[model samples]
Target: MARMLGCSSSYLHKKMKSIQISARKRFTPISDANLEEHVRRLHNQFPRSGSEMMRAYLHAEGIVVQRRRVRETLNRIDPAAAAQRWSQTVARRMYHVPFPNSLWHIDGHMRLIRWGFVTHAGIDGNTRLITYINCSTNNKALTVLSYLFGPPVGTGYPPESDRTTEGRILLWLF
Candidate 1:
C-alpha cells in the first residue's frame, strides 16, 4: 500500500506511528462522581466481593455495565479493593507420616441433615482409624472435651467436657 502511494517504507512507518490511536488515549465512558462513590460504598459493604458481585450490585441499583468496565471503574476507585492475581511458585508438598497415631484430624459435622443433631469425630491421619466419635445435642467445646479426655461417663455422672481440649489433643497426638 505504501509503495502504491509512492512513499518510502521508513517514512510511511513513522507517519503511521504518529497517527496511531491507542485505547489509553480514548475518553472513558464512565466519569460520573456518583459511580465512584457507589463503588467505594459497595467495597465497604462487601469487602470480599469481586467483579461478578459488583456487577450484580450495579444491576440491582439500576446501573448496568460490562464486567471489564466495572473492574476498570473499581480499580480507579480503590487499588486495594481490586482482585489481585497471584501464582504459586512453590509446589505444595504431599502429606507424609512415619507411623500410625502420629497425626489425628478432628472434624465436626454440625448436622447430618437440616434436622439432624451435631456429631464430632477424629481419625488417625496415618492409619485412617477413627480415634474418637461423639454425638451431642449441641456441638460445644465442653462436649468435645468430655468426649476426648473428660471424666468417665455413666448415668450418675454425665460425660465432663474440655476447654481447649481439642487443640491440646491435636498438639500431643499429631
Candidate 2:
C-alpha cells in the first residue's frame, strides 16, 4: 500500500500508528506469552506441519494469522528441524585437502560474455586463501606468466635466483 501511494512503508506505518494512538491499540506482553504457547502446542501436535499448514489449522479454529509469522515461530522452536527443511541434496563428489597451500584451484572468469577481459585467481585448497589474482585483456598463457613472473619488458628483473634468464616456458606433463 505504501509503495502504491509512492511513500515509504515506515512512513505509512508511523501514520497508521499515530492514528491508532488516540484509540490506544494494544497487543500486550500477555498476548505474546499466549502466542508462544499456542505456536508450541500446535507444533507439538503436528510436528511435520509447515507454515501454510499451521496457518490453515489456526484459520479453522477461527484464528487469523500470517504464514510467515507461524513459520518463524516454528523455526525458533526447533532450529534443527528448520535447517533440515531447507537442506539440499548431497554433492556427488566432495573434495578435501589435508593441509593449507597443498593444492591450489585456478579459475578464470570473463568480465562480460563476448568481448570482456578475464580475471584469473588461484585459491588454496585447505585455507581457501587467494594465492594470486590478476585481470588480463585476454585469457592467454603469456598473460598468466606475466602475473606469476613479471612483465615481459621490464627494466628490473625478479629477485628469485632460480628463475631462468633464457625463455623458459610452462610445460604441463599431464
Candidate 3:
C-alpha cells in the first residue's frame, strides 16, 4: 500500500500510529445519568444559570460535561424554565427617541474622581451627539445643574426630557 501510494512504509506506519493516537484522544460520550443528576441539582440550586455557567459549576465540582448536553438535560427536565431562559436571551428592549432634542442623557462619570476630576456629559438620545461635556473638580448640584442648563440656554431650547439617575441633581432640576 505504501509503495502504491508512493510513500515509505515507515511514513505510512507513522501516519497510522498518529491516527490511532487521535482516535484515543477523541471524546467519548459518557452516560447521561450522572451528568443529568448534577445538571438538575445545579439548575435547581442556581435556577438562573445558563448552560455555560452550569458547565462551569460542574467543572468546579470536578465533573466534566458538555454545554449542549447540559442545555438538553435542562430542557428535558424543566421545559418551562428552558423556554423562559430562551425568551429572556432573545428579548431585547428597543430604545427610541423621536428627535435629536427629544431626549437628553445626562450623567456624571466618576472614574477620574481619584484625580479630582468628574466628567459631566449630556448626549442627544436620537442623534447620539454630545450636547454638553465638562470636566470639573466637583459633581456638586450647582456644577451638574450648569451642565444641564448651559447648552440649552445657549441654543435657546431645552430638551423635552433629561434622563439622569442622580437623585439629588434630579430634584434640583425639577
In terms of TM-score, which candidate is strongest? Answer: 3
Task: Give the top-scoring candidate (lDDT).
Answer: 3
Poorest lDDT segment (10 consecutive residues) of candidate 3? 21-30
lDDT of 3: 0.76
Lowest summed lDDT across 10 adjacent residues in model 2 is found at 158-167
Q: What is the lDDT of residue 137 in candidate 1?
A: 80
lDDT tens digits by residue: candidate 3, 80-152: 9889888887656899988767766778899999999999887778888888889999978788777676785
| Predictions in order: lDDT | 0.64, 0.62, 0.76
Q: Rate residue 169 of model 1 by lDDT.
A: 47
Instruction: Decide which is better by TM-score, 1 or 2.
Output: 1
lDDT of 1 by residue, 13-68 (tens): 77777999333443335556767777788888987677788988977887766678
For residues 1-174, could you state the per-residue lDDT of candidate 2 as single tens digits?
789999998888899887874334322233545666787888899887777888777677666655666777778888787787667436578777777645555556776537766887655667776667777778776676666554233323222212222113333311
